[model samples]
Structure formats: structure tokens, C-alpha cells
Target: MQEETIKKFMYMNRKAPYGTIYALEALEVVLIGAAFDQDVSLAFLDDGVFQLVEGQDTDGIGVKNFSPAFRALGDYDVTKLFVEKESLEERGLSPDDLMELVWEDEDDDWAEKPSIRIVTRDELKSILGDQDVILSF
Candidate 1:
């Protein structure tokens, strides 16, 4: 059997969820990349933190809300979600303002656990340094 080379891919989301399509487009790429069985991780920074914010209502607009897609990432085996603490603070938001996202850990007896990790800006820098490839939006 041929061994598959698993490269570390980090998707850097730095835009707001609505108004522009960058956030949604980045999400589509992440979902596609997950299928290849590569080591995937998503970093939510700047206005990107708004993407995971709870209680999103797109009713005023004619667009369908796609925020729920973040909740399904676990099913695709894409569980590493990193949110920048500094970014949230700058935007006057906290962890409580975000949705509680969980994923099933098959190795841990199929246990459900939170998938989002709130990290400092310095920590995020370290994470970026460790990634083999980074797709920034």
C-alpha cells in the first residue's frame, strides 16, 4: 500500500462573515480539502471571529444562512478550530458570544467534545509557523 503524505493545511479566515463572500468561499475550500485526509486546521482572526458568532439572522437579507456549516465540520473530520483571543477582544466579543461547537471523538469512545480552541495571538503565530501550507482569506 502506498503511504499518503499528510500535509498540515491551515485556513486563515480574516474577514467578516456577511457583506462579502470571502468567508463563505474559504469555507467551501476547507470542506473540499478535508476530503483528501490532510491534517486540517482553521484559524479565525480579525473579523473572522464573527463567522462563529451565535444568533445569526440573515432574514433581513435574501441569502441563506451558511453559519450552520461550521457545526458540520466535525462530520468531515475537520475538528481543529482555533479562534484568536486578541481579535475577539478588539471586536468587543468574548468566547460566550460564540456558538458552542462540538465534535465526536471516535478514538475516545465516540465521545462528544468542544472543537473550538480560543488561543492568544502569540499562540496563533506559533501555529501558523508550524503549518506546511496556509490559505489566507
Candidate 2:
């Protein structure tokens, strides 16, 4: 059997969750990409961090709040979620302000682990360099 080439795929999210469809569309792509069983990672920087902010009330705007979808990514094996620290700080948000998302590591005794990773801007640069392909939204 031929071995599947596992590529490093990174989704660069730089837009806000609402006012447009970029964030949601990116998420749909992420879910589909995860099915390929590739090394997938999601980077939330700039206004993209807003997508992780808790208590998003879209009720007034008549939009369905899809923040809960992030919590479901773990089931699809999409676990590497990186958030820029400076972006969060600038937006007055801490990790506590985001939803608690976790993924089960089947290779590591099926242990539950936090999927979100808080990284500095420098670390984010390195992360971008490490990706084989980057899909920006």
C-alpha cells in the first residue's frame, strides 16, 4: 500500500467572526480538511481571536452563534489551535474568556487535552514557517 503524504496545513484566520463570512467559511474548510487526516493547525491572529471570545450574542443580529462549533473540532482530530497572545491581550481577552475546548489523544492513552495553544508573535512566525501550506481567511 502506498503511504499517504501527510502535509502540514495551517489555516490563517485574520478576520472577525461576524460582519462577513470568512471566519465561518474557514471553519467549514477546516472540518473538511481534518477528514484527510493531515497535520492541520489553526492560527487565530488579529481580529480572528474574536471568534474564540465567549458569550457571543448573535441573537440580536439574527445570526446563528457558531462558536460552539469550535468545541466540536476535537472529534474530527483537528487539535492544534494556536492563538496569538498579543492579539488576545490587545482585545482585552484572556484564555479564560474563550471556550474550554479539548481533544482526546488516542495515541496517548486516550487522554483528554486542551486543543488551544497560546503563543507569542515570535513563536507564531516560526509556526507559519513550519507549515507546508497556509490557507488564509
Candidate 3:
């Protein structure tokens, strides 16, 4: 019997949810990576933060709102969503403007805990440096 090696995979999203396919494609890749049981993390910087914004209405854009798919990440054990603080501030947005995403901790009696982590640019850089593999979108 051999122990499986889990590599740290980080998906970096730097685009808005709509107006392009980058965001959506990155999301699907994240879910696929999670399915493989690899250690996964998501980093949202620049316009990527917009992907997590709450109350997104795309009727006028004729694009199907995919914000809800973010909430389902926890079900795939894909937590550790990192948002750059400077990016949010630069866009005049705050954590409150984003959707509240959480994951259940089975060890803690299934208690829900936040999955989104707000980090400064320096902090995010350090976190990114620690990843075994990083896929940018």
C-alpha cells in the first residue's frame, strides 16, 4: 500500500465573473481539482474579487448568474478562498459586499466556519509562494 501524495494547488483568478470566460473556467477547474482530492486553494485578486460579490444581477447582460456556484465549493472540500485586501479597497468594496461562504467542520460537530480569508498583498504573496502549483486565470 502506498500513501497518496496531495499537492497544494492554487487557482488564481484575476478577472471578473462575466464579460469573459476566465472566471468561469477557473471555477470549473477548481472543482475538478477538488474532485481529485488535491489540496486546493483559490486566490481572488484584481477584478477577480467581483466574482464573490453578493446580489449580482446579470439580467441586462444576458449572462446567467454563477455566483451561487461559489457557495457550493465547500461541498467539494474546496475552501481557503483568499481575497486580496488592497484589491477590494482599490475597487471600493469590502468583505461585507461579498457573499458569506462557509464550510462545515465535521470534527467540530459540523459547525460552520468561514471559507473566505481577506489578506493583504504581502500576505497573499507569501501564501502564493507556499503553493506547490499555481494556475492563473
Candidate 4:
């Protein structure tokens, strides 16, 4: 039997959490890809950084707040969440504005580690270049 090759998949999100379905759709796809044992990572740039901001209240918008779902990504082994630093700066935001996301590293005796990485645009470009497949939303 041929060995299954695990492909590197990167989902690039460039939309707001609400006002459109792009952010949510990309998240769902990321989970599906991870379930297949593929290498998966997420890139949040532009308005997509808003997706991870803490204290999200959608009550006034009549939409269910899906921010909590991001916390569950680590459980699914979808831990690499790369947020572009420039994007946050442009919006007058910082890493402190994002929700705290961590994953348990079993190899490290289950020590908790952060999943979100605040990367520069140049760093993100290199990461995107290394991916086998990149789906932008």
C-alpha cells in the first residue's frame, strides 16, 4: 500500500468575523483538513485579525458569536494560527487584544503553549510560500 502523503495546507483569512461568511467558512475547512491528518495552519491578515479579538459581542448584530470556536481549534490539532503584525497595527490593535489560545504539548509532558503567533508580513509571506496549498478567504 502506498503511504499517504500529508500535505501542508494554509488557510489565509482576510475578512471580518461578521458581515460575511468567509471567516467562518475558512475555519470549518481548516478543521476538516486537520481531521484528515494533513498539516494545517491558519493565516489571519487584514480585517481577519478581528476574528480573534477577545470580548466579541454579536448580540446587537443578531449573529451568534463564533469566536469561542477558535479556542477549540487546538483540541483538533489545528494550533498554528499566524496573525500578521502589520494588520493589527494598522487597526490600532495588538496581541493583547486577541483571545488567549493555547494547546497542550503531549511530548512536552502536556505543557500548555500558545497557538497564535504574531508574525511580521515578511515572515508570513515566507510561510505562505512554503505551503503546499493555500486557500484564501
What are the TM-scores, per candidate, against the unseen true structure?
Answer: 0.96, 0.95, 0.95, 0.95
Q: In model 3, what lDDT does residue 70 have? A: 94
Which pairs of residues collide in candidate 3? Answer: none
Where does candidate 3 have its weakest 10-residue lDDT segment? 1-10
Task: Report the lDDT tens digits of candidate 3 across residue range 1-137.
Answer: 24498889999999998889889888888877787888899999999999999999989999888889999999899879999999999999999999999999999999999999999999999999999999987
Over 4 Å off, model 1: 1-3
Q: How many angstroms is residue 94 displaced in model 2 relative to the true structure, after the best TM-score fit? A: 1.1
Candidate 1: the clashing residue pairs are none
lDDT of 4 by residue, 1-137 (tens): 44498889899899998889988888888877777888899999999999999999999999988889899999998889999999999999999999999999999999999999999999999999999988987
Q: Number of clashing pairs, model 2?
A: 0
Q: Runs in model 3 with CA error above 4 Å?
A: 1-3
Worst 10 residues of 4 by lDDT: 1-10
- Candidate 3 local lDDT, residue 110: 92
C-alpha positional error of residue 12 in candidate 2 after TM-score superposition, expressed in Å: 0.4
What's the C-alpha lDDT at position 53 in model 4? 97
